[model samples]
Structure formats: C-alpha cells, structure tokens
Target: MTEKEWNGDFDPMADPEEQKTLLSVLDSLRSYRRLAHFNSTHVRRQAFYSLPSQHWTLLSQPPFSVLDSLSKLDDLIDSNAELAEAIFLEGFKAFMAPSLDSEWVASIVPEKYAHDEYQIYSIVMDHLNVQTTQGDMDKARSCVNQFYREWSAEGNMERGKCYEPIINALYTEFTARSQDILDLDKSDLKVLVPGAGLGRLVFDVCRAGYTVEGNEFSYHEIMASSLVLNHTDKAGQFNIAPFALGCSNHLSRADQFRTYSIPDVHPRSLLESEGTEEKVPPYERMSMATGDFCVIYSQPSYKGAFDVVATVFFIDTAPNIIRYVEAVRNCLKPNGLWINLGPLLWHHASRIQCSGDENEENNDDLKYHGHIDAGVGDPGSVELTDEEVVALVKHFGFEIERHEPGSVETGYISNRKSMLQNTYRASFWIARKK
Candidate 1:
C-alpha cells in the first residue's frame, strides 16, 4: 500500500497512537503552565477556577468522554483537585441550580443507600441551620448535643462492624514508614496523630515506645478510639504500651488526647459529679515525658506546639483544603515532620443495587441508619487532592521531603453482604517545616 493511500483512509481521532501523541503534547504544556501558575499566588487561584471549567467543558463533550476528559485533566492537575472539582461542579450544578453558596438538599439518595442517607442528612442539616442562626452559644451547644445524641442512638445499634483488616493494613504501612525515620529511643520524643480515628496509630506508636497522643475533633471518634485503645484485645494482642493519663493538676504539660476531654467538655451535671474527679489511667503505659508532643491537629490549629505531626487519610476530609493545611502547619514546631497518607482526590458516592434476596432487605435499612448517624450528605463537604494538599502545606512553610503517588492500599474485607469492598490507592508525603 502506498503511504498516501494508507494515510488517506486514516482518521486521526480514531487512531490511539495519534491521540496518545496529542495528549502527551497537551500534558507537557499543561505541566509547564501549572508550575508557572503555582509559582505565582494570583495565577494559581485563577488557575484553579479555569482548570475546573476547562475540565467540565472537556468532560461534557462524546464517547468515553467522561473518563477520557478525566484522564486528560488528571495529567494536568493533581488527582485530589480533579476528583473534588468534578464532584463539586457536577453535584453543585445539579443540586444548587442557581447559587454556588446556596444550600442543597439531595434529591435522590443512591437507591441502595437512600433511606440511610435521608435520615442522617435531615438531622445534620437541621443541626447546621440551627447552629447558623442561633446567636446564643449555649443554645447552639444544646443543639449540637441533641444532634449527637440522636445520631449516636442510631449509630451504636446499626453501625457496621469496624473492618479490622483495613485498619491493620493502614497501621502496618504507617508504623513501617514512621520507624524508618523516627528515633523512638530518643527519650522525650513525642508524636501527634491528628484526627487519630479509633486510636489505631496512636496505640501502635505507644507500643513502639514513643509517647504519642491523638487529637480528634469529633466526640464520637474520640470515644470510639478510647474504647478501641482501652478495651479491645487488639491492644493486648499488639502488646502496645499506654500513655500515662494525666490529671487536671498536670496542666503545665499534657499531651493532646490526655489533657483534654474528647468533646473538650461534658454536661454540667457530668462535670459537677463526684466521679468526675476520678482519674482514668492514661490510655497507654509510658514514662512521663518532660515535654509536650509536636502536636498534629488535622484540619485545625493547635499552633506552634508539635515536634512531629502526622495525618493519614486526613487532608481530603477538609471542607477547605487550604485552611486545613494552614491549621496543621501552625501546630508543628519549627523543623517538625509532617506525614500524610491516603487518596489526594476522591469522593464517595452511594449507589443501591439489588441483593436478590428478601432477607437482605433489612440490611439496606441498617446501612441507611449508619449513613444518617455518620451524616454523609453533600459532595463538597470533604474534598481535596495531593497537589492542593502539597501546595497548601508549602504555603505554610513546609518543605516537601518525599511525595509518592499511589503509594499504599487499604485492604478492607467484610463478611457482611451489605459492606462493599472498596480499594483505595493513596498518595504519601513526608514534609518538614522550613
């Protein structure tokens, strides 16, 4: 066949080779633009909006279009940004309709998860609205209390059993990496696990002879972690040591978790009781360190206190990524370490599928109840990405030590038919304050 004849019938759009070449060129250009834009604060903010718009335009266009568009944009921006922006833009357009700032009630929950989400979203929205309008701090506090009480009443009974394997995998990866760099024998070495869900990592660190504390914003998470650390065989099976629980008198120096109540305060009656004076032993057994931890407060500020801070699967949980990193950076001491793990850009969507059995119908209600208890509505609530996370952290004066894309997998398994096996590939970063 003649070269011209062969070329005559060729369609560039249909050719994978041609498409790949064009994509590479576009990607190279985008990368250069991103670096240039990021270096300038003004340009970066503009880039954020423009890039998302461009993605929407491209994604809104043909066959394999959504996936293709994502692939193209993913090459240009960070994954977290891509995922978050996509979810926000799509969900906002559908739900918000007129104003970006307007509140949106979900129209339909994924068929499988609808009832569960409906109840949770209803309570949470009511709580949010009430909190927004009430000038009375006391009233607001009461509202918050009521919200949690209602949530917990449902959550305790129907919440799916914690997936032990995923937790173990996460712990294994975290400890292995941490031990490589951290000198545990350096007495008075302190670590902070901000948003230390369920105390898995904190428990492990204490076991490793490092005095560690967890800082969690949610009272539910704190209580859950306390139970897991204090009551479970997992702690004994792992032979993890406990940190010395300090009393109110030890106020001069106290680790984050040990020093404060999980909710930071209890009901006045609970506070006024005789039992309130009883000191619970610190969750772990460890020597009294003379100094405080280099605190890591994920998505919030503990400001200028920690020697080391670590947030695993944390940045994405922030409603505002930039604000979250600033808070985390503010908590770290000068030259302190910051470690992060988990997917940079991702969103969880609920979808219903038929289980093909009448017995399985009740499982749907249980799942729905769990969602209500956990308060899982709205797309923008928790959205962030690796690039944005890095950028935000750097904005707070952290120098990147290492960044690995797709570094870890959370192996989650469940015998419960209702539980979905979701695999997460996460980015890992270790940064130090400049």
Candidate 2:
C-alpha cells in the first residue's frame, strides 16, 4: 500500500494532506481499486521513461544523432510513449466530463458505495486522481485494446454478437412504417442504455435514428469515452498501439505491436442520407447521463419515460438483480419493451473459476462467496436460476415475449491470435410491460 503513494514533494491534490491519507485503506474493494488505478497505471511508466534517461547522451554520440539516428530502442521509446500520451494526457483525460471528475468518482458506488463500510469516498477520489501501480500494466493494456472492440470496424464481429440483437430489437418497432419512407421519423422513440461502457452501443443506437441516452457509473470508462464521442472529428481520427504492452499469447511481436484506428463511424454524421434532401443531423438526440443506474433513472420524471430499454452484457453489474428489474419496470411506459442479453455473472453475489474453457457444462462448477441472487431472491442478491429469473420478471408485471437461453456466443475484447479464447453462451430475452 505504501508503494502506491506518490512522492511527497509534489502535490497532486489541492486539498489538505489528511484527505489523501485514507486511500490505502480504501483500496481493498474490488471495483473501487480497479477505477482508482485505471489512469495511474496507464501512462509514463518506468518502461517508457527508462529509455530516455539512459539514451539522452546517445543522441550526442556519432551515429545516433547523425545518419544512423533511429534505433530499435528509439522506436520503442517514441512509439509507445507517443501513443500513451495521446490517450491519457492530450486526449481523453483532458476532456473528462465534470460529472466524472475526481470527486464524483469516489462517491458513485452503486447503491452502497458511500455507505458505512466504504466511507473513504474523498480518499478514493484522491486515489483516482493520483495513485500509481506497476503490476496492473497488463490490465491497462487490455483496456486500451477495448477501444478496438467498441469503436473500430475490426471489432464488429465481437461487438455484433452483443450489440446487434439489442439494436435490431429496437429497430423492429420501426419496421411497421410505410414502405416508401426510408429511415422515417423515429425522433419520437427513446432508448436507454445502462452500463454504457465507452458508449459504443449508445452511439450506434443514436445513429440508428432514435433519441438515445446512456447511463454509466464507471469513471474509468466515461473519462476515456468522452473524448471519442465529443472531440473526434472524423473516422479513424485517432490511432492506438493497443497491444504494445501485452507480453503473452502473441505468436509474433507483429501481433502485439499492431496499430488500430478507432471510430469506424463518425459521431457527427449519424444521420444517414436517403433522398438527398440534405437533412439536418439531430445531434441533440444522443446523450450520456452519468451516475448509478438504479439511482439516476429511479427519478419520478423518468417513470414511463422511455419506449425501449436496451441492455447488453450489463444486467450482471447489479449488486441486487431485483433493483435492476424494478428500475426497468418503473422507467418503461406501459407495454414498453425491455431487451436484455448477458450472462448472469452477478457482480456482488459470487466468485468464478480462474482458468479453463468456460461452458454450459463447466459453468456449474462455479462456487459462491456470499448469498447469491438465487433461491427466494432476497435483497442482498441471491443467484436465481434461469427459470427463477423469468419468474421475477412475471412477478414484476412483465409478460415474457421470448426466452432464448444460450442463444448468443460472443467474446469480450478478445485477442484472436491468443492461445485461448473465452466466449459466453449468454441468456437473451424480451419482455413487454403488461
């Protein structure tokens, strides 16, 4: 914990010293610790800095600065650092939304984040702004490549498995319009995406001609996504060396160091052209709201506020699954549709097996650490069986439209060439408010 401390000489915070002291004790929570270190482990590490310190004098020597100036070491230092700087310093963090600013991140623990057991909210904010650790570099690298999965065309296959169903479910309602009109007036429709990581699903839904709002609770995601959604000017406006820091599962260095361009689709050009009437783009239709899902959308005004609520790989984030069900039922209009696709990887109720090819057969081998959202479905969350989940939906006044278990198989931000690939045989369903 002491090693996570920054040098005392330079102040990363403007607040009093006592505000920075409790972060070490607060770092024990699994989710909090991940967000706290996301930015710190991401940039300007010893690996990148070591090159310049040792080679400052090399440029002054004969072949280095002259005709033979660029070396493999020079390439390593320049390329990796340049990319890291763009993503962390000059890019995303520069445009972070005020809602995701350091202070807000510390307080946003879904339902119980700021409760008695997790009181170091301000200290956690301080840690998010300044803490650093070296061992988490691999996690940082995976996060970097996540941009590829969400924003690049290369990720369409993986993203499509989860995203397409949700998008198509929303689109099905639009199909009833007259055949002559292509992309007819969908301005009346509203869509909500919770756990909208990096906002790709939000972006796609907005592009498809619906008024879309994405709700998010993670600062680590919103900080990085804001730059792309708001500031990027064109398709492929930014390039990342996504796999440069990963050292394992590569058949070759070429796989690790490959460059990937983000944002296969431009944000401003969401309104696709049809009859050449020069339609004014409806930029106002898209928005991202920040805060815990159960808290923010639970407002009186949000009741029956949306026509469709689309979730993909997100429902599992709930500390209590019933809160999620209630949130959906309350926010949706009568007969409004709820579309969900994700494995029941309950975030709060249980633990998982570490290594193996996870499958329906092996899934039963999973063990639990606490009370799961099962049997009787109590408040702290019990892991309910598939049929029990359907029962929960019916009890909450949702008529099951369809239940297709193990219908979707998709990888999450997978490294295709790696020795292993893990895919989910996800649960998918559509329910109408009765």
Candidate 3:
C-alpha cells in the first residue's frame, strides 16, 4: 500500500511560489472587472440592484458576496498575496460545491453547442476540483465572463423566444396601424429590420406575411444566427447556461443556476390562430445582411426601397444615433412607416474619448468599429435624450404618427436568479415618412 503523505507538509510561517500565481490571477480578475464596465455588465448590474429581496432570497445561499470578495482580494493582493490565494481557494470551493445540476445542463443544451456546453460544465467541475487545492472566486468570475462573451448569442436567442410581450405589442401595433395602408394580397410589403441581432424579431415580422430583410452588425452574432436558423425548425428549443460561473456580488443567487431553453419563433405565431390542413405560402421572405446599417442604406438601390423600417433595441447602438435616423429616412419611401421599440440607451454615445473632433461626423478614415458617419457637419460625440431623438427623426422628414411611452420586461441572456437583467422602458413609435 502507498504511504499517505502528511496532510500538512508546508510550514505555516513560510510563504511559497503559489503567491506568484495568486497575484497573476488577481491581476487578471482586475482586468475582467474593467472589461465588465465596458460590456453590458454595467446595465446588468443596475438591473440586479433593482431586484426585490424576496426574489433573491428564494434563489441564493448565504455568504453570497462577490463585491466583498473583490474588495478583500484587492487588499490581500496588495498586501499579502499568499493569504489572498488561501481565502480565494476557500471561496472558489464554496462556489463549486456539489449543489450544481450538471445532468440537467447537459440535457437541455443544444446539440450544436455540445463542445462549448461540455466545456462550460467541465471547466466548473475541473476548477472545483482544483479549488480543493487552489482557486478563487475571482477566477470563477473570470471564467463566467469568458463563457458569456463566447455564448452570449445563444443565450440572447433563448431570450428572444421568451420575448412574447414585445412581439405581441408590435404585432397589435402593426396590424392596427398598417392594415388599411398595406395590401398583403396584392403585394408583400418590403420590411427592413436594422440591428437584427439573432433574427428572431425578423422571423416574427416575416410571419406576418411581409418580405423581411434583417441587418446585423456583429460577425459573431451573424454566425450564431445562421447556426440557429439553419439547424432548428420553426419550433425547436435549445438550452444555455448564462450565469453559472460568475462569482460577482451582483450575482445574488448562485445556487439557482441552471440551463434555460431557447424557444422557437413559428410562422405567423403572433396571429394567434389554430392550425389548418389547407396549404399556405411558406415563410421564405426572410434573409439577413451583414454590414454597417448606415453604409448599406446609402447605396442607391436600397434607398427608398423599403415600405416599413422596424428597429427594436437597435437605434441606440450608433455612436451618433442621428446617423441612424438619417439612414432610416434614406431607406424608406414616401409614406413608408418607421416602427421602433427600444430603450434610449445609447450604447456608443457614452462620453468616452474620441479621435479627430466631436463636431466632425464625416472625418474620412476616422474608423472606429461601428462609427456612423452622420454625414458632413454632424456632431458625433453626444448622446441625445429620448425627446431629442424623436425631434431629430421629425427633422429628417418623419412625422410621428403614434408615440407610446412605456416600459417592457425585456432582457438578453439573463438568468432566472443571476445578477444581470435587461428590463427597461422602451419608447414605441410609428413614424411615417412625409
């Protein structure tokens, strides 16, 4: 029989090389915290803070303190790296205890993401085992953050299926407003969905018997959308583990972590009618374009081609949203309607530093990732208020036909008990091109 080694081999007073590793891990975690600020995590944190205690109490175990851990780790890394590592390992073990439901996760996750799905589960289990010897809550948080960055599209697609309230709201609004104006029998109305992330909303629009074109900016989202659209049927479901690995204090309910199903969008699903045996025209009018929204519409053929321009959770993505308004105006024919539903959260309009000058909108070769050239003499730095945005739309020849100010319970890649939630008030409008 192999002799058992001493349970405590190292001297309590003597610090070792593990401290170096701990310092490295802490530094990486600090970088992640910085990155989290830039990503949608800031908004997600706001949503977490707004949750009621009852909801959190139902989903979490005691000693759930991500921010506290961060603060403590910061102090330790700055003073005594060895001590920080020890405490971090303890917290990591607590995070990875046997309570997680791995079997359930494997079962619901889409077969297409089998590798990432397995990798997600494997990483947690492997790290938990490592925590028995060495690990950190910060490290776990980093893992979760990485997972989210890679799998966010899948998670968002899941939420899009659950986006019934928004879908119903739009369906009702479109039918009531456009029924008299649009002749579906004579011609399929040309519809354009800008910033169509995963094409779920586009599918919804197509179901209403309109020819739809979805525009997406991100290459990753475009690929994810293609995977989902090609592999899944109209009503297929998949699963995603959105927040199982994060150890952030905002993650108030870690124990409630589990996989969630991505629901499917059926043809004419919003119509709310029973199925019929009679043959119907199949939904083939839907297609997606990968390019900058402002750049694509500037082309002569695309200008004044679409009958309806619908943007949901999209317009605010531009650095200068006025450019978005201009692009929409350029694309819609006279009397065409521009339907929009989203919060006025200008993603790129944050008062961050800009090259060239704030007043210069068309600084040629002034290329940021999604920089919108709002044309010459455009101010590109400042973010406009919701009222200001509407005014700009009106200035661009769009007359506000209907404007409804209300909130919607919406989120992307949110967990049942995680810290991040995307719920916010959305300004809905039906602006007709005059």
RMSD of each: 26.6, 12.6, 17.1
In order, the Cα lDDT scores of the candidates are 0.39, 0.60, 0.51
lDDT of 3 by residue, 1-434 (tens): 00110111222113333323233333333233343343333554456556797765443444655344334333322322222222233322222224457676566555776665323443443343222112333443334322232233445544453344445544654576567765433125677888776566666665555567788644334434454444344443433334533445343432333443444343344332422321233234667775667777866778898878888778777777767787888899887888877777765554444465762433422332233333212444567778888889898888998787664455544554555555666777778899
lDDT of 1 by residue, 1-434 (tens): 01121111123335543333222222222232243224433343355446667775664466325444333333333422222222222222222233322243343333454455333333333333221111122221222222221123222221112222223433543465567776424224456666565444554444444456565533223323333333222211211001111112222212211111122122222222422322322222221111112212321445665666667666665544554566557777777777777665433323233456863433322221112222221123444456766777777788997887775654222111222345566677778888
What lDDT score is found at residue 360 in candidate 1? 49
In angstroms, give how far residue 412 of model 2 lies from its true place: 0.3
TM-score of 1: 0.37
Q: For residues 188-271, what per-residue lDDT tens digits would candidate 2 score against the true structure?
A: 678888888888888788777778788764434544566567656788876665554444687765675566677787765544
Best candidate (score: lDDT):
2
Candidate 3 local lDDT, residue 7: 14
Model 2 steric clash pairs = 372-381, 372-382, 372-383, 373-381, 373-382, 373-383, 373-384, 374-382, 374-383, 374-384
lDDT of residue 387 for candidate 1: 75
Of the candidates numbered 1 and 2, which has the greater TM-score value?
2
Give me candidate 3's TM-score against the actual structure: 0.54
Q: TM-score winner among the candidates?
A: 2
- TM agreement with the true structure for every prediction: 0.37, 0.65, 0.54
Candidate 1 wrong stretches, greater than 4 Å: 1-184, 232-302, 345-382, 412-421
Clashing pairs in 3: 66-249
